[model samples]
Structures are given as structure tokens and as C-alpha cells.
Target: MATATLISTISTNLRQPTATFQPKTPLLFRRRQVVAFESKPWESQEKVLRENAFVCAASRRNSNSSSSITVTDVSVSELDDKLRKVLQFVLWAAEGVYIIWLFLLPYAPGDPVWAISSDTINSLIGLSLNFFFLLPLANSVGIHLLDAPVLHPMSEGLFNFVIGWTFMFAPLLFTDRKRDRYKGSLDVLWGFQMFLTNTFLIPYMAIRLNKPDTKYTPRKDSQLGSVMVNGASVVGVIGGAACLISILWGLFGRSDSDFGSVADRWEFVVSYLGSERLAYAFIWDICLYIVFQPWLIGENLENVEKGKVNIVKYLRFVPVFGLVAYLLCLDVDEEV
Candidate 1:
């Protein structure tokens, strides 16, 4: 009885030990999971920062290259921007002056931009065509716009070929800047939008052949991406050729009426002085427009006395509006 009492007393005094602890396995696993989750993003952030630093350094190295003489030093992007701004400003200002003068020709101050008469817009339609075709040829006849010097008796005729090319080339410029207000553009929707990557060929040539046979491709992609790019490139070339051909056809396919001689004929003088017939004005406009091409080209040509005028790009269109007006006149002639 004494022994049994003593054992019972010991058991009661010591409560059973509960399962309370682990070997720290779960805690270790949780810590490892958190580190792994954070590592990938951290590595990515580091890579981005390093890349940005490299670019920043390269740009700084190139920023002042034009001041010195070196092949790689022209600061190409900056030069292009400067040219663009200058061009845009010149174009807008000239257009604005001409439009205003045309709107209020009779009362406007001293001969505002070619004495633009306040003719109705309706009269101006189709007039642009004349500038596109005849002016170049008339220029061939020695009546250069602004009465510019006739390089030769046949200068105007010789100029016709260049003007034809410019007119036929109308399509690509339209596509490149579709928002631009030119006619015959909407009809070409979904007609295999050209890549004009061939135009980039000029830049590539500038970099490659200009250099020691170095190439112009930027970083290459994966094999699949490369294949896709090459395919798109080929398609671009074909589409550009098609567009060029179509535009060329329009300029070259002049009617007998187009190539007809107008000087000294009653039809010519009557067409010039008569009522606001769309056709006559259109023909005259084309003549004057092409007449003006050389003048505008001169404006773009660089001179030491004048600063560079890269912005002089497409200023040829300032006179083109006059040509379009002529085409509108033709529509009237057809109607009567």
C-alpha cells in the first residue's frame, strides 16, 4: 500500500510532457522560399540600371562630335531634328502667307506670295494637275519659275523628265504621311501598305558602303524573328515597286489634250482670260507649278552664306497646290 501510494504521488506531481517542438525544418523552408521569390526581380532591376548607364555614357560621348572632324562624329539624330524643325517652320509660314494672299488677293498688301487671287475653291480643283505635267515641260521651254536663268535652250524640256519622276513618286509620300491632305490616297486602302524599307537602303548605304563594308542591321533577333523580318522586308520591296510604277503611269499617261501646244492659239489666250473655267486655270497652274520647282529646289540647296535648310524638304508642294487647282478646271472642261 505504501509503495502504491508513493508511485501515484510521483505520477500526479509530473504531468505528461506534450509534443511542443520541431527541428526548425519548416522555418528554414519558409526563409528559402522568400529569398527565391525576391531574387529574380532584383536581378532584373540590376540589369536595367546597368543598361541605362551604358546608354547614358554612349550618348554623352557622341553629343559633341560635330565640333571636331571624325567619321562617326556628326550627331546624326540631332542633325536630323534640327533640319526637320527648320523645314517645318519654313513650310508652314510659306503656306500660311500664300493661303492668306490667295484668299484676299485684290486688297492684300504688295503682291503677297505670287499675287494669289481670291479665286473660289471650286475653281481650284484639278488645277494641280497642270503644275504636275506642263510646268516642267514649259520649264523645258525656258520659262523657269521666278525667271530663273535658263541653263540651256532645252533646259525646260530636260526638266520634264525630273518633274515626271517627282509626280509619279507621289504615292509613297502619301502613304508615309497619310494624314497629309493629298488626293487619290483613300482609293489605295489595304493595297499592301509598303514597308519602304528600300528607302532605308539609303541610310544603310550611308553607313555601310560609306564605311569599310560594315553592315547597318541593328541587333538581330531570334531565328524566327529574323525570318519574319526578312519576309516583311521582301514584301516591302515588292510593294514599293508597285506603288512607284502606278504613280509613274499616272504622270506618263497624258492625253493628246495634255501634250497639245497652247501658245498663241485663241484657245490658249481665251483659256487664260476667260470666265472661271476649271480646265484653263488647271493647265496654267501646272505650268507655273513646274516652273517653280527649280526655284524651290534652289531654296533647299545648301549655301555657305545661308545656314543649312534640311527643312527645305517637300517645300516643292508649296507650288503643287497651284497645280492641283488646274486639274479641277479639266473636270469642268469635260462637263461642258
Candidate 2:
């Protein structure tokens, strides 16, 4: 009996300890599972935060791109507008200076319009007759259509040289895409230009800068315009050849007369330009023509034949010949 009681007490003690520890172990395990569940939610929350950040960054990039494009477009438009205004101002200013320097200034070389001399008048008549040798060549060949005036070869050559260049501009002016912008009669303007030269042309240059009229109808090409446009190649060759000949003629013409050597003729020309108003004015016209020729041709490169556009585009930077070449390569079939 003593042995059985002792064994039972030992077993009771061991069972009591196991029951107490098992309940506490299960409670600790449950607390650890709660911590694991909480950590899983934190991982999902972190993933959501990263996704939102990516979306916000992408939206910002698109917004910045659109804003930059808008800014670039606005800037280009503003720059173009400013440039046009500046060009208009410069053209008008040139006109003012041209009138003042050539006509109004008494101190300028040669006679003012109000006080032109008879010798100057005689020189003008001779130079005009010498142009294309319309009268002089006829007289020389014994046709005797009109009596040609006699003047220094230098004066004759210079006058015709300028006129030749002026003639080529007819095709350019008529074919200008913006020609309809001018409201005046082109016939009258060009007629005046043939005699008056830049006195009329400068104003036309400035006036052509007027903003396009949306409601205005473009006019049909005039009869003169048609002639010039159709015969552009012939005009180019004739004008270009005339210009080349004029230079040579200035240096060597009137060989039978007492004009002296080329060096001496060159010296006389230098003095004439400094002392004669017409000669001085011609210098101004030539300078202005240099600028205007490239300006006009470069703007109208589209009028050139397709295969010849690159040729004319580069040649526009050249002086008188550049314009001549442009005329020779004009696309006659294209509408002005």
C-alpha cells in the first residue's frame, strides 16, 4: 500500500506541471501569429506607397513635357513676330534716309533735282540712247532712227549697266508670291521705276511688307507681268550679257576716241562718282540692289524649277548674275 501511494503522488506532480506550461505556450504562439499578420499588412501598405509614388512621378513627367512644348511654341511665335516688326522698321528707315541723302541734301555730290545742269541732261540723254544701243547702234549701222547723244564711255556704260540689272527685276517683281499685296498699279510703278529706279522701288519694298489681307482677292497677272514671266529666260540672258558688256565697255569703249588708257578711265570714274550726284546716286542704287536681290530671290526659291532649286538657292547670294540665273531657272508652268 505504501509503495502505491508514493508512485501516485509523483505522477500527480508531473501532470500538474505539464498542464500549466501547455496553456502558457499556446498563448505565446497566438501572440507570435498576431505579430506575423500585422507585418504582412505593413508589406502591402509599403507596396501601395511605391505604386502611388511611381504614378505621381509619371504624371509629373507628362505635365512637364506638355508645358515645355507649349513654352517652345509660344517663344517661336513671339520671336517671329518681333523679327517681322524689326524688318519693317528698318525698311521704312532706309526709305527716309534714301530721300534725305539723295534728293534733299544740297551738299551731296552732283546737282539736286531743282538745280540739274544742262550737261547732266545731255549725259542722261546720251546714256539712255546708249542702252542696248537702241539708238546709237542704229545710227552706227546707218539706220539713223534717232540722233544718239555723245558722252564719256564711263557714263554711258554705268547708266546702261544699272538699267540692265533693273530690267531683270521685272520678272522677279511680277512673279513675287506677295506681289498682290501692293494695291497700286504695277504698270505705273514699274514704268516709273524704269526711269526713276529706286526712287519707286524702295517704297514698293516697304509697302510689300503689309500684313496679308484675308478677305482680299488676288488679282490676275497683268499683261506686262505675263510678258516678263513668260520671257524670263530671255530677259535674264539679255540683262546678264548687257551687264557684262557694260563693264568691259566702261573700261575700253570709244577706242577710236581720246578716252586714254584703262587706268586713266578708272581714275576719271572715281572723280566722277565723288563729284557727280547722278553717279553718287547710282552707287547707292547698286548697294541697295545687292541687298534686295538676295532678299527677293531667297524668299522666292519655291518659284524655281524643282531640279534647279538648290542651284538658285545658293546663287541668290551672288550679285546680279544670281538674279539672272534665278530668272533663267524660273518654273514658268507654276502659278505665281
Candidate 3:
């Protein structure tokens, strides 16, 4: 009975629940699991910082290079501007000196050479044509033909014409449109003066050198203007043709006692003026015409509509300067 009670007591002791404590999972571990489940993809902080630094360095290098180039270009441009101004000033001074010399030549001691030179220049200038031609006429009349009256008008006319033409035409050569009323009026005034004098052309050319290229617009012609242009052209052609025929007749056909042939008239002209003076005058006429004619054609062409293969423009290069022919054949745009 004791053994049985002892076994029962041991069994009861084993079967009875023991008072034992079990530890719970850590709070930090649970939080980490939740974060891992919810987290998005992200770059490493160190890698991001390195990439930003590289970009900043590249930008700095590019900025430094660009700034250096800009500084160099500015300095070069300033130098060129200064050089151009100096060149222009020198040219202007030279031209002024020449003009003054030409004015003073008449008062200078009259050597035979100088007198002959002056007479020759006067003959080609057209100012003294009446004077020279009138000399023979004056011989027929009672008056004696003198060099003073002839030379004075010739020199004065040439100088005045140069100045007037230059100033009047400069603005026209450079600008396509005149938006300013004051400037437009000034241009008109200059143009009017050119018709009278033609000497202001020198200053006009100087002014043009400093001007920028302007955008050109073609001008439309009106009915009356077109009619006038055509009429003028036709008249010019007829007059030119007559003039040419007259010259050819004088050169070849004329058998007058005085001024019989082209050669005879040329000899008379040379004898009347002087070889040195005539030569200089001829040279100046040729040079001035050569220099101015191209610009004149260009100015006229600017207002005309362009098309493929303009034969008339090409014909400008023909001998005898082709100026008369050009004027006769091609109608200039009259809108401007």
C-alpha cells in the first residue's frame, strides 16, 4: 500500500503543471522584419555623393574653358576695330590733302607743264567743252579764248560734283530701307545737292565704309513710274545711237578743212591742252569711271527682281564700259 501511494504521489507530481516562464520575441527584431517588407530600392549614399561631385567638376571645367575663349575673342575683335578706324582716318586725311592741293594748283607758279596739265584736265571734265569749242567759235567771233575762265569752271564743277554725288549716294548704297524721317530728308537733300554739285561723293563713300550691310527688299513699280522709266530708256537709246553715229561719222566720214578726221581732232585737242595735262586728265577719267560704274550698276540692280542667268548684268563687263548700252537695254527698278 505504501509503494502504491508513493507511485501515485510521483505520478501526480509529474502530471501536475510546473510554473515555468517562456521568453517572448524581441521588439527590435519584429520592427526590422516589418521595415524589410515595406522598403523600396535606393542608391547607396556614398555612390550618389561621388556622382554629384563628378558632375560639378565637369561643369566647372566647361565654364572655365568657355569663359577663356570668350575673353580671347573679345580682345581680338577690339584690336581689329581699332585698326580699321586708324586705316579709315589715314585714307580720309590723304583725300583731304589731295583736294586742297587741287584747289591751290591754279595759284601756284605757272610752269608751262602745269598750265598744259590744267588745260588737259579741264577739257576731259566737260566743264570747259564750251570754252574749248567756243575758242574756234570765238576766233570766228571777236572774243579771245583764255585758259583762266575755262580752267576755273572745269575744276570747280568737278570738285562740286564729286562732293555732291558722294554724300547723296552713300546712304542709298548702304541702306535698303530708310525708316527715320530725318535721315530720309537728309538723304533727299544730299541727292538734290548732288544734282547741283556732285563733289560730296567723297564723304559719302567714306561714310559707306563704316556702314553695315542692310537687308534688301524689292520695290514694286507703279503704272506712271513704269511708263516714265520705259520712256526714259527709249529716249536714252535713241540719243546714244545718234551720238554713236555722229562720233563714227566725225571719226571716219567727215572731210572738213578743219578737224577733218578722228586723228586730226585728237591732235587738235592735244595741241590745245598739252600732252602731259591731257594724259593725266584721260587717266583720271578712266580710273574714276572704272571705280564708280560697278557700284552704280549694283545699286540699280538691288531694286530689280532676280531670275536665272541675267545676261544684262554680265554684259556690264563689255568694253567702252558698256554703261550707255546697259542704260539703254535694261529698265532700272524705278520704285526706289
Candidate 4:
């Protein structure tokens, strides 16, 4: 009976479906098995950490580059400001001294401002007549409109030469980018400058150096400015021709005037500067022009045509002819 019972149990076990059977296990062991089958989190976390480190390094580099650029810009601005201040101070000082020494001081090599000499007046009249001299040249050719005063050609030539060169500066001043920095009318200033020369120009130079303000609006150009800017080439030609003619006239002009040889004319010029206040003041104007010509030209080089900029830049240091060349080479189409 027991053997028959055993056989029945085995048959019962074999008859059940194989899918119905399951083995029991400890809970801890089952938890460990499930954990083992999952994907690794540490590798992914490491990749994410590396990516973040790279981003931070790149940001730091960019910040460093920006900081360096900012420092460079600040330094350049400071240097320019310092230079502007120095130039303004020097120009103002020059103006004060120029007024005192030329106009007020009795110690200078010419007559004082309070006194007037008939000989000086006569010389002034002669120089003025010699400037255009339509009647004088006509008189020289026997078609006299009036009597022409006879004078030393060297003195006349030197005076007109300086004046003619100064005439060209009118256009240059009108077209300057910094012209608006001046509060006064350019027309009056330039007009006076023709007679007084540096007395007006030096003040304008110093005034223009003032820092531009937000309240300032650019003024429309005056009729004089328009004429000068438009006729710059004509002005250049006239001024340049005048200068050339002045030199030639000094050396060989007025053949009938009994002026001595070139050596004698040169001697007269040397003595004339020492003896006449007007002539002595002209010497001061010439020196100032030499310094100012390059300064104004260098600043306005952008107004020159592209092809001629390099040439104008180098020639600017030259005195009278340099200004002539610039006016001739101006880009007239450019707005002043």
C-alpha cells in the first residue's frame, strides 16, 4: 500500500504543468539580483560632471579676455584725455604771451601800441598797394590810374605772402570736425583772423579743445563757410600763386623801383623785421602757422581723398605750400 501511495504522488507531480512550479528565495538575495540587472549610474554621472567642468573653463577664459580688453580701452582713453588737456593749457598760455609781447610791451623791437609813426603808416600803405597792384602794374606799364607808392619789394612780398597763406586757413577751419566745439560765429572769427592772424586763431584753437557737451547742437554753416568750402580749390590756387609770386617779386619784381640786388633785398628784410612792429608781428604769425598747419592738417586728413591722404600727411609739416597742396587735394563732395 505504501509503495502504491508513493507511485501515485510521483504521477501527481509529473501530471502538473512545468510552468506552474516556482522556487522560494530569501528577500535580501532577491533584492540583490534585481539591483545587479540595472544599468550603471556612476558612468553617466561622471560624463555629466566632465561636461560641466569644460563649460566652466570656457566661461572663465571668455571673462578673462573681456577683462583684458576693457583694461586696454580704458588706458587708451586716459592717454588721449591727458594729451588733450596738455595741448589746451599750452595754447592758452601762448595766446596770453602773444598778446602781451606783440601788442602791449614797449620793450619789443617795434613801436609801442600807443604810438604811431608816419613812416610806418607810409610803409603799410605801400605794402597794401603792392598786394593786388592792378594800378601799380598798370602804372609800371604806363597806364596809370593813380600814383603808385615805391617801396622795398622784399618787405611787401613777405607781408603779402604770409597774408595769402593765412587766407587759405579759412577753408580749413570751416571744414574742421571740431569746428562746432567753438560757440562763436566762425564768420566773424575768420574775418578778424585775416587782419589780426593768431590773435583770433589761437583763442579758437584753445576753445575748440573743450569737452563736447550733450546740450550742444551742430550749427548750420554760414554763407562764408559755404563759400570757403565750395571755393577751396580756387582759394588754394590764389594763395599758392600769391606765395610764389611774392617770392619772385621779392627777388626781381619792380625792376624800375631802384630796389637793390637779391643780397640787398635780403638785408632789408632782416632789418625790416627788427625795425617795424607790423613786420615783427608777422614773424610771430609765421612761426605759429608752422606749428598749427600740421596740427590742423593731421586732424583733418580724413577729409582728403583716399588716394592723396598719405601725400597730404607727409607734406603737412611743410609751411605754406603744404596748406596749398591740402586745399587743392580736398574731397569737396564730403560734407563739412
Candidate 5:
């Protein structure tokens, strides 16, 4: 009976549905288990971490390169500044030495003509009278003097003419109009006096040095006509004409027979070099032409207009003809 009952129970179990024997877990949980078995979150995290490390390394390299470049640039800038300062000091020292040599040249050994010639003295007196009295007296009556000759002894005329024109040309090289003062009238006057004496230029230079920071409206800020009509042009024209006339007369005209014949002028120049006054004068003139003029030209270059080429700045380094070239190429309208 027991065996028969057992067989009947098995038959009853086999006849029941298979679903009745399933687990208690939900269908959604089983689907998630299958997905978790296929995908790996930890492996994906490891891959992302590796990519991040690589990016950080590249960024570090770029930063290091930029830092190195910055350091190199700073070093180069510092070196350039030092070199510029050294050059400026050398120039100043050279100018000082030249001035000292001029002062001492008069005291050098050997007999030198220190006293002014009687002929020069007489010429000066005549010049003073003509400028102070005759010219003014003639102008009051609407009668203009064609020319007033001040320099005596054709050699003196040549000296004054050369020096005066140099002075007139100098202010044009100044970058700052205010530093030049009075529309460069003072510079013109000082330059004009350079023909008579270099002593005047010393004071002018002293004043300029002491007030190097003086400020004024830049030429670029004002109307072009303002600068053009400020009398500088008129003065320049007159002074240029006078200088040309004096140069011609000194080279060829026979005004003073006392200085010897025109052919002997070269000999007179040689002898004049031996004189203390003329030696000092000549030295000062050289200093102005070589040292000061070039310096001023460099300053003027700082104010050049954008996109404009200033060839005169480089040309100013050439002797004699350089200044002439600069004047010819000067564009007043383009100056700062």
C-alpha cells in the first residue's frame, strides 16, 4: 500500500505546472542580474582614470614650456635694458670729455692768440650799431635794409655762419616742443649767438638738462597749421638765406684785405687752429655737430608717426651731409 501511495504522489507532482516551482525573486531583478553579468562598471572607471592621467600630464608639460618661455623673455628684456643704459653712460662720458678738452685747449703750451683782433673788435662795433640803430631806423621809415653784415674778417663770418646754422638745425631734432621752449625761439636765438660765441649755448644746454621733464602739447594733438605758422618756418627761411650768403661771401668774396688774399684763407684757417679761442670754438662746434646733433635726432625718432618710415634717423649718423638730408626729408605734418 505504501509503495502504491508513493507512486501516486509522484504522478500528481509530475502532472502539476512547472511554473509552480519557480523562485520568489521579481522578473525585473532577474533582468538586472543578466545585464550586470554582461557589463563591468569597475573596468570602465579604470579606463576613464587612465585618460584623465594622460590629460593632466599633457597640461603639465604645456605649463612648464610656457613658464620657461616667460623666464627667457624676462632675461632677454633685462639684458637689453642694461645694454641701453651702458650705451647712454658711454655717450654722456664722451660728451663730458669733449667739453673738458675744449676748456683746457686754451691753456695748452705755446704762444696762442687769446686776445680778440682789433679788426674783429671794430667789426663787432659796426655790427652792433647797424643792428641796434641803423636797421631799426631804416625800418621805421619803411626802408628795409637788404642785408646786415655783422661778422668781420671773412674767416669770422664763415665761423659764425657754420655754427649758427648748426644751432638752428638742432631744435628740429627735439621730440618735445615744450622742452624746446617758446616755439624753439630760444633755441634759434642761442644758435644764432653760436656764431658769435659758444658760451651762450652752454646756458641753453644747462637749462634744457635741468628741465628735461617739461611737458607740452604734442604736435600730433594740434592742427598742422599751428606748427607751420608759428614763425619757425619764417625764421628758418631767413636764417637759411643769410647763412648761404655768408658762406658764399666767406668762400669767395673779398671783404677784409687784412686777413690776406682769398687763396691764403686756407693758411689762415691753419694758423687759426693754433689760436686758443678758435681752437676752443672749433672743438665746441665739432661737439655740437657730432654728439649733440645725433643725440637730438635719436630723440626726434621716438615721436615718429605709426606706419611711417623715418630714414633720416639712420641717416643722421652720417657726418655733414646727414643733417642736410634730414632737413630735406623732414615732414612737419607727420611729426608727433
Candidate 6:
């Protein structure tokens, strides 16, 4: 009777609807791929656990690993540290480029360019370009701010131009990695480059985008001299305000209906042998080079080495004098 009942039950299960499928547990239905794990009975599982522990420890050393690792071997989170280092590097690159292009290059007298441009584009281009900048590239060709020759001796204007943009471009390589900040900066750069390429759009965009409480506020809480930087901004603001006041005092509130008056006053103050601005800019460049540049570069170099990504040690081989030449005309003078 028992055998007959068991057979009947088996037949019933087999005859059940063909479409019905049984649910599978992981261990029951998993496809078994053949992998050779050779070890003494009872030892293979132990070996795997030991190997896994070693792997967990080794992964902790990765620079990109999280700072927040745990015994369960969660990867270390370096989000903050890596980002800070990257931001510093971006700033260094921007500042270094600025010093070379704006400050040093411009220091050379403008007579060469002035003579070159004198006829066609010079007279008008200088007035247009020298709106705020002191370097009257146009004036060198033949333009006057107010019956006075409007030229910044080349170097003074170049320095300001480069330094100003250095701050603007610094954040590009910086990965606050904060998506919102990153997106905001990308927008600003796009806008800036657009304006640079087309000067006529400036007034239109200014009106369209510049609502004091609404559109004009800086996109992100930034690090450069913004209130975002604690001590630095405070110091910079006070000094910057003072300089701005002095500049306006010399520049505006005039009835002469002059065109390049603002540009002329700036050149008078920053030109070499004219004001201390050249020396001052050079000094700041040196401070940045010696104190900040090396450390930032070093951090990146180390990261490359540790990552096993090959790098030329050309930076190490570079002479310290290269940096020194930045603040003073060391290279130019020494060669001369």
C-alpha cells in the first residue's frame, strides 16, 4: 500500500501543469562551473579566508582608497585628501602660467610692438583693449588716453592681466568633486570664454545675467579671495578695497570726457620705474613659487610614482634658479 501511494504522489507531481516552475535557492539551482581548488580536506576553506585577509590589508594602502576604512576591510575614503591636493595643483599651474605670460613677458618694453602696429589696427585696438588694463598696446601704435601717451611699458599691464586670470583659471583642474560647484564653474568658464571671443556681447550679457541679488552672486563658495577663504579673503578684501579706492580716485569723477583716462592712471602706477607694482608682483610670484609651487608639484609626482604610471623626473632635475628667475629678471639678466 505504501509503495503504491508513493508512486501515485510522484506521478501527480510529474503531471502538474508544465508551465509551473519551482522557485530555486542559490545553492540548489546555481550552475556549477568547474574550478580547481586543490587542498587537503578541511584546509581549502581556511586558505581562502587567509588569502582574503591579506588582500584586504593590501588594498588599504591605495592612495585613492577611502580614509574611512574599517576592520570589515571597507576601502579607505580619500575623497577629501585627494581633492585638496588636486585643487592645490590646479592653483599652482594657473599661477605659474600667469607669472610667465603676464608678468615676465610683458615687462619687456613695448617699442617693438608699438612700432609694428602703428598704422592700421594699433590706434583703435589699443583704446578698445586698454579699457581697464594699463598696457596700452594700442597707445604704442598711436592712441592717447587724454592727450597723454597711453602705454603701460608693456610689463605692468601684462602682469595684472596674467595674475587676474590665474585666479580665474585656478579652479579648472580643481575637483571640489562637488558636482554642483563643478557645474557652476563650468558655466562660468563657458561664459567667460564666450565673452572673450566676442566683445560686443559684453553689455548684453551683463544686463541679461547681472541681477544683483539674483543672477550676479558668485556661483559657488570659492576659495580664491572670496569670503569662502577665511583669513585670506579678509586680508585680500581690505587691501583690494584700498587699492580700488585709490585707483578710482585717480581715474574717474572727471569732466574731461576722456577715453582711456582709467587705463592711463593704471599704467602710471604699475609701470616699471614708474611704480612699485612690478616689484610687488614679482615678490608675490616668488612667494608662490617657493612656498606653494614645489609642494603641490611634489604631491602630484608622488601620486604618479605610487600609481606606477611612468613619469619623467624632469621636475626634480629642474633648477631652483628657474623659479628665482620668475621674481627677478635673473635668467634674462644673467644671460645678458
Please state every model's RMSD to the true fold in angstroms: 22.9, 14.3, 19.4, 15.5, 17.0, 20.8
Clashes found in each candidate (C-alpha, N, C closer than 3 A): 25, 2, 18, 0, 0, 10
Report the Cα lDDT for candidate 6.
Answer: 0.36
Task: Report the C-alpha displacement of residue 289, candidate 1, in angstroms.
Answer: 6.7
Q: Of the pair 1 and 2, which is ahead by TM-score?
A: 2
- How far residue 50's Cα lies from its native spot in candidate 6, in Å, is 17
Q: Report how far residue 84 has shifted in candidate 2, in Å.
A: 1.1
lDDT at 84 for candidate 2? 76
> What's each prediction's TM-score?
0.24, 0.79, 0.42, 0.77, 0.50, 0.24
Write model 4 residue lDDT over 31-129, tens digit each, in one string: 434344434498865565564565556666678577877888899999999999999999999999999999888878878777768887788877777
Q: Please list the residue runs of candidate 1 whose C-alpha ends up more than 4 Å from where it truly belongs after superposition.
A: 1-76, 107-170, 177-263, 266-336
Which regions of candidate 2 deviate over 4 angstroms? 1-71
TM-score of 1: 0.24
Q: Model 2, 108-134: lDDT tens per residue?
A: 998888888998887877787687657
lDDT scores in order = 0.35, 0.84, 0.43, 0.84, 0.51, 0.36
Question: Which sections of candidate 5 miss by over 4 Å?
Answer: 1-66, 104-154, 173-243, 255-259, 298-321, 324-329
Relative to the unseen true structure, what is the C-alpha lDDT of residue 23 in candidate 1, on a scale of 0 to 100?
A: 53
Per-residue lDDT of candidate 3, residues 201-253 (tens digit):
34444444463535544335335334434554453444344334434533442
Q: Which residue pairs overlap in candidate 6's backbone?
A: 65-76, 66-76, 66-77, 66-78, 67-76, 67-77, 102-158, 106-155, 107-155, 126-138
| Model 2: ten consecutive residues of lowest lDDT | 30-39
lDDT of 5 by residue, 49-139 (tens): 5645655666666786778778878999889778766665654665565455544444632223454567645654554444323443465
> What is the alpha-carbon lDDT for the whole of candidate 2?
0.84
TM-score head-to-head 5 vs 6, winner: 5
Tens digit per residue, CA lDDT, model 1, 29-128: 4443434344357777667556456556667676776544353445775676677566556545544544444334544322233453465332232233
What TM-score does prediction 2 earn?
A: 0.79
User: How many Å off is the CA of 213 in candidate 4?
Assistant: 2.6
Q: Which of the two, 2 or 5, has more lDDT?
A: 2
Q: Pairing residues by index, what is the TM-score of model 6?
A: 0.24
